[model samples]
Target: MKIVATEGCHLIGKNGERWIDGMASWWSACHGYNHPHVREAVTAQLQRMPHVMFGGITHDPAERLASRLAEVAPDDLNHVFFSDSGSVAVEVAMKMAIGHWRRHDRPGRTRFLAFENAYHGDTTGAMSLCDPQRSMHARYSGAITQQFHVPLPRDETTETNLDRVLAEHSDSIAGVFVEPLVQGAGGMRFHDVNTLTRIRDACRRHDLLLIADEIATGFQRTGKMFAVDHTADLPSPVVPDILCLGKALTAGTMSMAVTIARSHVFDSFYSDDPGAALMHGPTFMANPL
Candidate 1:
């Protein structure tokens, strides 16, 4: 039979039986389906202002959400790059990392490092940072940039492995991408916070940018506002150079995602020459309805 409606955490199928939605609609519907509050908000939004392209314009929902995010984000991650979905958010983060290095005059540091069994998203650039042996896009290996893969550490001691990986490829590494404490798409593998802290330390020591893919762990899903909040073992709180977020940006009401970076990272795109500006953007980049 087919499910027709949802309330609270239960779904009502055609048979009239109520069942809990264990997967939460691919893990994005934190508030579940047919939630009264969500329904009202969406309906109200549709009446007032339904759709708007963000290519060069802004709307109330987008602006309010961006402001809320900046207020809640970690220090200096005040900038927000909006996209339609998580996959696109990942692509934005990757591009920002590359641009950050290029703008800083480190053009040769173009390679990226990600953990084995870590899944960022399905986009081409996101897929490249994923370990092909464990990623679904193994067949499309030739299309990706072939990032270095570090095995997820089982304990704090595994910091040595991260050090070794950085030592071997520090020169070419542009950034180190991670899924934080829990590697969601990789069968929900859980690692220690110290492991993330170590990775962060290694990235800083080697001058590599740290990109936290918190798409799955944002919005208190993991009992924290962001997964990086769990990393208290580091000498200081580790703030990623770039952060990719989605799924809960608008309480899952709208299809929205954001790529937040430090101001310096954004500065790279500022130039007198039009060609020097970051040329990558979707047609809906700043569209407003």
Candidate 2:
């Protein structure tokens, strides 16, 4: 069925029949489709200008939106790096984690550890985190960079192996990637909150970064603004060192995503030497529209 139009959670078919949206339009239209507020915002933005380069200039909507995002996101996730898609955002997050360690004289900490049946995104770095056993990227196994993978969390065994792997790879591991309470693309798998606590504890004890790919489960999808919010009950209750958010951001009206980091991570790249800066940046990073 061809959809000619959409409004809220319904789509208008070619024959003019209305169909309820079952997939949230790939889980992007969290506010439904063609929402009035978003439509109005776009219309107002159109009157001013559709878009402007972000390399050296600033704009109103982008500033306001970034501030609003920082307000609602997990504590200290204040630094935002915009991108064109979730996959790219994940790639950037990985770079941020590795860069953070490298700037501190641990360049060998370039590896990551994810779980079985996990799915972060489709880009090369993101695909490295995806489950290869029955995934679409199985054929690319020998093509992309390889990372460490372990079984999904279940009991004490999961924590044990996770800690053991971190201990064994203590000098080489960069970060531990997780999708939090719900692993959306990995068959909608859900794990206990204690599992998240365990992962957080492990990352802390090992002095490694914890990156939560919230592209598929952010913005109240998992009954909280972000999946990392569920980690509030942990002993420390701190947010992930870094987070990647997309899909629901901007209510899905635009192709936008962001990689957010805490102050410490941002400070790592803070330097007088130009070469110490983050070398990666998207052209459309902070477009006004």
TM-scores of all models? 0.91, 0.96
> Lowest lDDT 10-mer window, candidate 1?
280-289
* Candidate No. with top TM-score: 2
- As a TM-score, model 1 comes out at 0.91
Q: What would the per-residue lDDT of candidate 1 be over residues 183-206, giving only the tens digit for each residue? A: 888888887776777787788788
Best by lDDT: 2
Candidates in order have lDDT scores of 0.79, 0.86
Candidate 2 lowest-lDDT run of ten: 229-238
What ranges in model 2 sit over 4 Å off?
none
